[model samples]
Target: MERARKPTALATTPGLPPQPQVTLTDSNARLTATLPTGESIDILLHGATILSWKDAAGRENFWLSDAAKLDGSGAARGGIPIVFPVFGTSDGHGAEKLPQHGFARNSRWEFLGKSTSEAAKEGVKLDFGLSSQNLSDDVRAQWPYTFGLLYSVTLDRGSLNTTLVVTNDGDVPFEFQTLLHNYFRVDDIEKVTVKGFEDAPYVDKADQFKTKTQAGAVTFAGETDSVYTPAQGPGHPLVIEEDGKPRFRIVRDNLEDAVVFNPWVDKARSMGDFEPKDGWKKMLCVEPGSVSKWQTLEKGDAFEAAQTIYLV
Candidate 1:
């Protein structure tokens, strides 16, 4: 038998230590999981940005944009990212437009490690932290409230749960608006309808911003925008029906307002990247946002709001 050639160091050690089992970086927030079909979900919280969300089928069609980059750029409410600290334009109760959705969403955040229970059986939870001690020019120029924001994102059993924990770090109290601007993917907007808030109170985006009744099950007839107040509680699931069959369910807790929007005509056409006509027909936004008035969070106190998205 020919003597085997002396094994070279390179040949003996194949492929860099198996590439280190797990990848821990700012983009992934150090969470862990292996999907049933052998895929993964990565959560990036720097500036509260969702860096990447790849499904089991190796599909990552979800929107991923830098929240920080959109500051003062007027692209605030167009994606799946969540922003807090006086959502929308506050009419006069400390609603500062310059900071639109506060600095937490756009400011860099520090990883807080595996949530005391970050990883769950059905999903993995990752936590990030931000406090006044970490504020910079951009944050200070805004609300000027000394606070801490803890963001928890969990991916499990065919859905994602995002929770926001706001803590008061200052000596005084403050009031603000919040929102989890959910950007759900769908086959087509025309082929779907949002069912949940029917007959519930809603303020139309048009007609001088007055409250009105839905009159019937929600459907995309045209450019639709409305602010809902005194929203129905638990069990009143916000169902997104695709072709009359439930496709996805959005459930929110402790959120008093639910804003629904689909920019079909004017607003969609104004954006260069958005194919006005096709865009609206492709996506419908159901904002589980807190607005129309300010909610209070006192010193040394904390408040939380969360929402879960599930496949149907």
Candidate 2:
């Protein structure tokens, strides 16, 4: 009998740069993207939450609480949590019965896989999907509308882009609100200032939801929960500066409202999942969304919005 032929190993082509990679870990519950330049991102299937984002130098760009639950027990306390359907508690408009921030942050999403594009600086984009059929009976009974959500997370050289597409799969129209609750890590919350909201009108949620206009760039003092509608319009870039130097710049597409929040001392200590009691001193939330009013989505129609955060 002739001897079996030996198998040969495949080799990578020379002179080409290393490609970006996407890895699934923790029994496929988490997806991580590593770029050729050493930048990386981690996302969980639960709520499709982005848990961590690191630069090429291995410095973390987002904050994740030490006490955050990663076992899918509850919404992670930090990082970027996606808010959909109803923002916070509903105020009538057909979503009053829905839970706070709706079900997107609490529901498990399906990983739709990843794709690469040279147009995005050879970056990799991961897609996630959540639909009405995937919802629990309790959640479905509360809203009773068939909808689909397509979330894309792209990791580029010096930026991260997140886009959401909401499709009305049912026969009736539905009103909803959406936002990206980004918990950004900072060296010192007191030294951080958020620009691009100057002269904008905002609602001070910490003060009985009073409406006020922002006089200057936002700074931290105590408990802060203000939602601003920028006069500069939807595509303007919001800059986060620390110690008079730019740290991160956020640009939103089709997302008009911005929310700045920090639980501060008292509220931070009250939250069971927020660690170290003083952990609030190291994080700030500069969220972009469409929360000033409910977005009405007609049947068979879709609405899309995106935000890109760049390191500075």
Candidate 3:
């Protein structure tokens, strides 16, 4: 995979804080980042999944299910899971009929090391690599496309940044989907209001693939699953408002679609992996993705998608 610049010196970031120290520990199974402030981020190498991200005040911006399995058997039930090559079960669109959300989140990834950027000095970055060359025979046979993935997780002053860089190393072009299945923290599913998607067109996955236009800000009252497009508001972040105040702000770049979902009651109870029947009340998935359009990459071509999150 194409490598980023070597870790650079901390550049002057007027609004950002001091740079953090990044380390790989837990027997090379996890990477922990400690910022100058009291905040920290933990990334598990298993799936290149973010296990935890705490703000300066030690408040968590992510929600990991209480019943989540952390034994490295598969992807954890929470935090932010990267869905690539495909977002979900095939409903058409030539998506690889592989596992739900694909193997990126289920298979282990190589720790490709970390780097720093002069543009963002207060931030510390960790990188993980995955490729068809490292996949199990079963997975390779299912979707025989040679690809390289470089996933980066960063924590700076007061923001969390996750970036995915995909490279097509195969001879023929391949079609795929990519997304950040972000499970954000919430006090009440009923009181939390989401913005940036108003007036956007979406595919109501909960309603038989029905296409509809968003009438207003989104709220969770029942089962909610919709794929929104052009989610980039004119100049605004996707804000999560609670008790009439903003709490989480998310921004995505190089990604066209955004999916917001909450299984609510019945659906939440149906998944064995998700513990606590009422866990739906504590989390909301506002996924930034390239789902509405199938991204086709030719030989040696690459694509990158990134999301930055701030706790307000």
Candidate 4:
């Protein structure tokens, strides 16, 4: 994994508010009722917590990280973070140009608008934006690309739907990898299994591009890493079953790849930020991403990907 260069500080937008100043701050992570539907969804970038995300019948649909057990101060690092152009790797080995996951997620994005109206369902929709104009010197020095990453999250109609549009606004074009990095809540990693794209080609990172498949209904017995390729078209639905029953189905459209990572033991012990045993069984990182040939965005051009998680 190449490290990105350390970023230098850039001047802030002349009239932007200081970081994390919400007009309605109950806490950094709190659920607010929206207009039409009146459904609430928990947001935890302040602390990886999701206090709400249930159905009308009150069924726990999404998986919550064990760290989600909030302390007196509420914050969890394991919830949802929009990973930009790159993930897990920088431009070099131990650079500060970009942090481990890039600047977009670490920077506090502005919540422009929100709604829970008829245009959507019982959940909420939030529109957030990040652009080169607002980036710090640190981010600019690392990649030197001017761009905007817009995220739209809607918990409506019994599904968690998100859309990310990466727009290149610099004088020159740029290329990079990305993922939604969704940490879906589940009952037990042991009790859960994923079904879809069995026999589909996958890249074995250890073998450096070797491809293989395990047929159908892949079960997570240990650490697993497979980059599912060419995941376009009317793709098969991915179902995560718990206790021999279907808990939820992840439905995607026009997606190119699925990065399935279940770092059961190794990831836990290695990362101090995560409680290995607590996280090992409660959630799965099923990312909808673009890699292989990095998704390129031309100046003023945009690329988009979206999906819905229907609670069953």
Candidate 5:
């Protein structure tokens, strides 16, 4: 059997800057990275949350709610929000309660600097690290497991490569779930078709978490929130397209499942953070994650997951 390689850095793309070309947005502290190819991406340092990603043509294709805050008071209403420690409101362990998606999406991470390798032939990658070392008492009180997390966001001409490396730095073992809550933009939600779920069983959140096997490609007609496990194989990448042209192509590694969601009319009205009740018509969140099973990491152990997104 072939040995699998452990992830230690960002996956290389064709062109990389000698160093990350970084700048801060004048309007907000969001950091922008411009690749040598002129493709660019924006990351808010507060949560290491991706705010915007532009394709080669400089056309932005990611979703951001008009009411989303760049100040980081809460998770930004859109783009790619990181989920860590716990996947949702309650971890079901009867422990102390946590916010909807844990604290990673709302906590500030340290900028560990950027690097590149001529031997590796990779693009400039930004490294952001988070440690419980400086977490406030309030944040630590909820789920106190010491950890070190390194998040790398790499910009490519047609794709964005994001990887999360989580290490258990505590004395005891810990269990957790994580997800990458990505909201992709579309001209019309109903018009887009998703491929790669066929024959896979899913937990339909709207149907009371009932498990059903996908008969074919998925399309949006009403509010949709479904979780599909072991979501890939020979079909490989998940493609979201309209009129047979690819919009977003998603590839995942070490991530075991996918969450497909759109809040639609009623849920959108109930969400105070979602701007404009009609915003649901233009976006969809096809998140890849490890929510199918909780990960138990022993002391000094590490876990990694990555998602590569291509926009055409």
Candidate 6:
């Protein structure tokens, strides 16, 4: 009797539409979403941190430090790092034991799944999840609280949107802060100017966190670290311009504060992970989040915020 022939695999079966171009690479540590127009984004599971975002012209939109550690040893120095639980150092409330910026930026998150939308604009959304049960022993012991985080990253034709939902799964209330630390790539720092915080009061972190009102559009002349809050009113969309040309437009929802930071010369060199020594001159950070004050989440409650960056 003749043996049965083996089946052959075809690249495209019949006449069905081709599947979306999304993949998980780098040993499943990274997820990439690509559009038909050649725009794409790369997200690392280490922090759900967006490592790269390229436009149709293959130009990078975010700056990743040359010396950034990609081995999951520590937080990456660049890209969009998610800050949660606490921002910078723990202020108080039995959270002094927690590490600066909490564990969100260093913890490994679960790749929840992916979805697609074709409403007003075609887009792909990748979801990541992290919870109390997934934390390391050390992180759990620091500020014990049952919480769950669902982070969604959406990429469209000319924009990227990131939304974070924090849920309290414990019986008691907990206080926390969250921010999307964005390191925007620029041709030169001297030509970059941030618009929208003209009259908003900001706390200058470089000068002992003293409160000061912005005189006009923010410009970097030296080391700058300021947290602009909604003192006057809720924030509007902010535009990042280079030599009077808009580069990126940032729109925030439910995120009440914005942070502008540049380590400059001494601080840049002081950071062991910031490579090239002068990388500061090529990058500017205009971050949006709910960080000026802590948000209280009661048991079974949830809070959500989002930020969208449009390429101009």
Error of 5 at 106 (Å): 0.7
Task: Give lDDT per model, in order.
Answer: 0.66, 0.93, 0.84, 0.64, 0.83, 0.89
Q: lDDT score, residue 10, model 4?
A: 98
Model 2 clashing residue pairs (backbone) = none
| Per-residue C-alpha lDDT of model 5 across residues 47-166, encoded as one tens digit per residue | 889888886578887889888877867889888989987777664752346787788888887777777622234356788988897577888888788999999887766778889999
Candidate topping lDDT: 2
The alpha-carbon lDDT assigned to residue 117 of candidate 5 equals 26
Model 2 shows how many backbone clashes?
0
Model 4's alpha-carbon lDDT is 0.64
Model 6, span 37-106: residue lDDT tens: 7889988899989999999899999999999878789998788999998888875955788888889999
Candidate 2: tens digits of C-alpha lDDT, residues 1-33: 765986677776678668888889999989899
Q: Alpha-carbon error at 258 in model 5, in Å? A: 0.6
Q: Give the root-mean-square deviation of each candidate in angstroms.
A: 6.8, 4.5, 9.1, 15.5, 10.7, 5.4
Candidate 6: where are CA atoms >4 Å away? 1-19, 118-121, 230-235
| Candidate 1 Cα outliers beyond 4 Å, as residue runs | 1-39, 42-44, 51-54, 58-79, 115-122, 272-277
Instruction: Tell me which of candidates 2 and 6 scores higher on TM-score.
Output: 2
Q: lDDT score, residue 197, model 6?
A: 91
Measured against the true structure, the TM-scores of the candidates, in listed sequence, are: 0.79, 0.94, 0.89, 0.78, 0.89, 0.93
lDDT of 6 at 247: 99
Q: Score candidate 1 by TM-score against the native.
A: 0.79
lDDT of 5 at 291: 83
Give a tens-digit lDDT track for model 3, residues 181-229: 9998787889999988878999998999999998788877799999998
